[model samples]
Target chain A: MNHVSDHDADHDSVYDGLLGGDDSQWAFGTDFEDPLAGVDTTLPEGVDGAALAAYCLMLGDDALVLSHRLSEWCSNAPDLEEDIALANVALDLLGQARLLLARAAAADPSVVPVLPEGSPVPREDALAFFRDQDAFRNVRLVEGDRGDFAVTTVRLLVASTWRLALMQRLVTSRDAVLAAIAAKAVKELAYHRDHAARWVVTLGRGTEESRRRTEAALATVWPLRWELDRTHEVERTLAADGVAVDPADVAAEVDVLLDQVLAAAGLEVPDVKRTGGLGGRTGRDGVHTEALGKVLAEMQSVARAHPAGRW
Target chain B: MSAVATVRTGYADPRAVAARVTDPEMPMLTLADLGVLRDVEVEGPGRVVVTITPTYSGCPAMATMRDDLVHALTDAGWSDVEVRVRLHPAWSTDWISDEGRQALREHGISPPGAAPHRDGPVPLNLMPTRRALTCPRCASPAVEVVSEFGPTACKASYRCTACLEPFEHVKEI
Candidate 1:
């Protein structure tokens, strides 16, 4: 039943010479095009590059961390349909993360870790893999483990709603690259939000057990929603400069959207205290939950081990 | 070079050759048919540049598309070929050509409808995508969604209630 060719019997591994045997081609493939190849990446006039870079990292890390979590649900989802759906959502977010991280590196190269010479690690890869836990800027909401299906669904619903709102306005960003990124992301986020919202309703209105678990999951995740809208100083600067959407500005909007989804699901927003970080510090300040360490450790293990090893 | 020399030099039209490059994921459609191939410019006798846009931010097919364009143009006699990606004016399903639509239907895949027109904020609708689509198999309008996500990022899985056959629909973004 093995239909695969055995022409390469001399090769120890089946994939030994995959993609022309170039090890570098194994990871991203040879002649990999830069995601932002022809896009203009210059900073807006009088805008602080460092702050923009930081802002990009904040958004990029959010997508990257949450994407990793979602991808973990690859085969573990409740059904085959749900499994493919989650993976698709993860892929969309991962794409957004790559572009944002690449933009961050373009805005300020200093933020990119100095990898070994001839490492062949792209700028975005270096930022994603080389950064320590203390350097990630994602909100604590997205860094946690892949909770139960209900938990994941609720978190996704909230996260996508917030992100969709932000991206809608980001289409007008002064920075063309960010604007372009947001324009495309807005559509994808809308789909992600729709998918999550539907699941939330299904879980809420399903059996009594499903409803109970959905309620419990909401309570578990509702606390982390606070950090999502809490704008960082970098975001404020970029927003003032018309280079970013102020997270605070979108707070009321996100709340209304979430309320609508919950209402349609015949569920109420869970009453929970806001999750607080060390006095005045939070994920935006690189103050993440302990869970982020585990997430990064798993994500960075392979790339860290082979800093210069292609593929 | 003289006009006769130019024709004899194996200098094929860069745009024409680049336009024939099909998408790696959806082989039924060319980059031109998918509207991903934005523009092509002949810099000199042997140098050419091709510009393309991604269907999605994280579309894995983009890398393949770029590679395919280079290969196609190179094989067509362009020695120095550069593929550049443009992000502005993001690619829309509306850009899929009429020919592309026919090709999809011929291959038992439903073509995308017009993209959602967003005048302001994109509204949150939990209902399934409301589109007028028929089963590519039996031409039956009765079909139900199997899943919003499909084997590829650009498609959605659905089954025809009439023919009882499964098919993929290119989702409108």
Candidate 2:
């Protein structure tokens, strides 16, 4: 059991009262009934709700799947300190995923993946733990195994860097909710990017083995990284309509930022090839690499097995 | 009970009521101290509108905060209440009031030392420990980070080497 303080003091502001303990359900890892309660849920004029829902899933799934992957390192990270750091990062992504999934549901209820009836899980949890592999919209990069510590760091650096760039642009979105979410989350994403960047730097320059592992990690992930930048047809259309930021638009910024981090870390940007093929389809099209199925199978197993159980 | 009748029967100003609604999670702080009591509007004689911003996108206390505001105002005899959440100009720890800082200290939690120079420059992060956080309990600079992620999203867990006590510090976001 963790020690939660009982101290409570009266502040000058009106929002003051004393809870006996850290009674916040979220602190104890419980979801609230509705995260979007009193906010106006109206879409901006001319923005398609269905399309907006689709757009939300694109971002949400990325965070959701990656969050799960990172959670795998909870007890398995190389060191105790790093175990907490990685889990914290995973929780941050999980938090974003929860919001994005909830937004998607609020935008269009049709987007909710079918969960077993009478399930007590929240809408966001349902989408996260119930959906099949092909239904997930995250990029192929985050779906793969947590290779080595070096691999995780480099992959995190690339993904978090790319996300920061997108989030920076997203703060100006036409959709007020989306813009608000981005604005609040950008700061978090900045920390995430910096955290990964520092690790990549340490690993790249520490010793011969670390340097080799970092380089190897970069090489392994760099080829598959191209898929993250390719925009889906829906995303492109939404970007044109001013509802979403196209994935392709952020590529330059991501590239420049990664290059700087890589150079500073004494690492090289590996010569990775694109896996894109006919129809320009990528993860955004409900298409993903072969690894995603195995990821989903493990992620969904517990929930699927015990559909009525509550965490 | 004597104060209740005088205050609740006809307290026209909704801010007074809304401000008193403590954050359910961090009980010592109020929405005003937290800098989230953005605006309170009196639509007509009895109608009121309140605006708030979340400290984080997935802040669970948001729903509780909204409900608390509505209930507190309604109990104060103000009908037709609307609580709206504003996301633009997102909430930051920097927005936390001085009174909020003092309150956090007294409640055994450390207020944010400084806002992370978020968009300042790329190297700000690479620089060693932007600012050292003092332990709220012992006011010692000898604290170490126990965990980057605390019990909740907006907090980081820290332990004081001086007092050997663990506490939560609001992380700059």
Candidate 3:
């Protein structure tokens, strides 16, 4: 009477190799190790670590949401190469999101409370499991809907332009993590901006229908542009410390670049009124649209499902 | 394993190593083949610095390529490797070598045509009408674009009626 043990079973052994075996020999480790270890954790003198973390979350959330929106067009893009291009851009933003979120979690003292023995939660776990949307600090442009190609391109141009400006300044940030992330992102955003700019010109100056549709998309998105320039005391504080972009400075440069792009396409800048009445302080105050909540659910769902599952 | 003992160590020249480092996205061409690997310098005893310029400002692979450079160099036994990214001269399709073009054609990607007349009266962006792309498979000047983009960002998808084959063409920058 031979008894088959579960551990000794051949079929179960094969399944274990496929599913649970230690396969860390891959090119990059697939095991769920934190990608942010060894990152410089010191904040600039006179800077509030918690505030900086909040600020970084805003930036990270913006990239993450926008990347998610762009990725939905993976196979649905006009062409195969364009599909690859969009996916590449989305991957770039996703990389930025990962680094920025890691930094935010590392900096925020409030997010990582003292354990039983007064030790703090690991930064990786904090970013992976903790934090909600109200804790997110991303901008309206990135969180906005993915409309037509024209709308997508317009938003890309606007977001990339402003991001480039901010990243240019960020290279000199007092925070090493911010500077490192910015240094890598500036180059990525430059290409993103160029890609969007080319599309905008092509669509805006193309046939009558294309031009009209692009103009309408621009008009629809123009009102949300004001939210990008909404300044806060935290931003001012960080800007003074040379750790964050002065939202006001980015606004002026963005306006000029946008104007030049519109002029080139022989299109007028839309006159849509800013949503100033609704208050532009929503993101900084931990307030967001229904879209963000939906996005967060999708993003965190997988990680939450199998809390400690390793691949 | 004794072949490893004969291998030269300590900061193998970047120019030599870079000759082998092809663009991951454009596998048909190497960094040296693309002329994007601008310079290689040996600093101090064991430190090697390789400089590269991106074809475009916001190319996502720039970071990955930098990491690749470091990994490749370090794996080859170079103790200290540094990759410096430069953007001054900005990459152009013109930088792509004839060898690279041949490789691209062999890989079913059409190399860019000669630069159109943009210096004269015509504006740079509006000047060139799309020219008939030659079938890389058959060399017949009868290919048509299936799509503006291909499997990757740098290439476009094209199909040749003559050969009845679909191919990826490296787009003109």
The DockQ value obtained for model 2 is 0.28
Q: Tens digit of lDDT per residue, candidate 1, span A51-102?
A: 9899999999999999999999999999998999999999999999999999
Q: Which ten residues in a row have the lowest lDDT in candidate 3 chain B?
A: B119-128
- The per-model lDDT (C-alpha) reads 0.88, 0.79, 0.70
C-alpha lDDT of residue B127 in model 2: 34
Better of 2 and 3 by lDDT: 2
* Candidate no. 3 TM-score: 0.67
Best by DockQ: 1
The regions of model 2 sitting more than 4 angstroms off are A1-32, A114-122, A276-280, A302-311, B1-18, B21-25, B37-52, B59-85, B114-124, B132-151, B156-168
DockQ of each: 0.61, 0.28, 0.11
User: B1-173, model 1: which lDDT tens digit per residue?
Assistant: 79655753788878888989888878989999999999998777688889998898888888878777777777788888888889988889999999999999999999998888888877878788777899999999999998889998898999999999999999998
Q: After superposition, how far is residue A261 of candidate 1 from its true place, in Å?
A: 1.2
Top-down lDDT ranking:
1, 2, 3
Where does candidate 3 stray beyond 4 Å? A1-22, A37-39, A109-130, A276-280, B1-173
Comparison by TM-score, 1 against 3, better one: 1
Best by lDDT: 1
Per-residue lDDT, model 3, residue A23, is: 43
- CAPRI-style grade of the A/B interface in model 1: medium
lDDT of 2 by residue, A162-240 (tens): 8878887887788878887887678788777888887888888799999999999988888778877877777887898
RMSD of each: 4.2, 8.5, 7.4
